[model samples]
Target: MASRLVAAAASSSSSSASPLARLISRRRLAGGADPHGPAKVNLWQDPMSPSKWKEEHFVLASLSMWGVVMYGGFKIFAGGKKENKNEAVPTQV
Candidate 1:
């Protein structure tokens, strides 16, 4: 009984939406403002850019450095990759 009522309500609401409204709603971004303009781009997404650092730059650099350090620490504590034991090929006669 309750399931029938919920199904009827959902069908009515969905049918009331115009085709254009449904398209617009379906195409909208999940959590951001309306998708009407070009996507935002960082002028200095490249870390090697000559542009001076902003607060975000510092945060990005720190995070990247921390990742490198953490990886190094893991390698040190967990043991690194084993070296190959295969014989080398001759390059010259």
Candidate 2:
């Protein structure tokens, strides 16, 4: 039992010399990321996993999406001012 513990510690110490292990060690030694800052979490990751979504979440999303759709519709019908100027502007004669 004591031998197994010693062997495990030896193996771990050996692994600490690995390239991947060294990168992890440097990050830890540098104190890693700002713990209090907002995270740039991946989109594929479940956003609700760490925090539960309340009514505010749905309300905020609904308002934002509503604004987006409204702006899109306005852009579609307004025939925007820059279209003629940007469209394949003809070069000199």
Candidate 3:
């Protein structure tokens, strides 16, 4: 009975899984998609028709404006706190 118990324990532990199973599972999850698929269609484009360059250009311009606004806000808030020592010096003294 003791030998049977020992054998069962050893079998269970050995059956646990090799590293290859884990590696394969990870690869299968990560490797399926193409990294360079075509860009997504804009809302203005019909699903069946190819997207026009003008529509893409409009979208890019809007995104660029949004980025500029965000950066301008950050710069304003960041630079607003700093006092210019040269401006603070009294020239009339």
Candidate 4:
């Protein structure tokens, strides 16, 4: 009797999954596999390999580099601007 019950339970579970459940399971299996290329890692984890770094990390690094460059250029060119501001305005009488 116990053997029959176990077999029945197994058969029910195997065949009775809802359509949505089957679809979700199939989607997960197909979409979760990244077979097109190798997986990426964090920037800090592998600093030497930019190609292996994740897309977001590359974007962040690029933005940060540009920000630094812009800031440095601004500072280099802005040094003369401060002196102009310090000049005394002509008295309005």
Q: Rate the local accuracy (lDDT) of all candidates.
A: 0.64, 0.59, 0.61, 0.76
lDDT of 1 by residue, 1-93 (tens): 565456555656777766454333243356676656544335366446525455566678779889999999999998888898999898996
Q: Any runs in candidate 3 off by more than 4 Å, and if so which?
A: 1-53, 80-93
Q: Which residue runs of candidate 2 sit more than 4 Å off their true CA positions?
A: 1-52, 82-93
- Highest-scoring model, TM-score: 4
Candidate 2: worst 10 consecutive residues by lDDT?
19-28
Better of 3 and 4 by lDDT: 4
Cα deviation of 79, candidate 4, in Å: 1.5
Best of the candidates, lDDT: 4
lDDT of 2 by residue, 1-91 (tens): 5654565556676655664443332233465555665544443355554343344565676688899999999999997777455578788
**Backbone clashes counted, model 4:** 0
Ranked candidates (TM-score, high to low): 4, 2, 1, 3
**What tens-digit string does per-residue lDDT give for candidate 3 at 1-93?**
565456555555565766444233234356558656666665456444445335666677679889999999999988856765765666795
TM-score of 1: 0.32
Superposed on all Cα atoms, model 3 deviates from the true structure by an RMSD in Å of 14.2
Worst 10 contiguous positions by lDDT, candidate 3: 19-28
Off by over 4 Å in 1: 1-52, 82-93
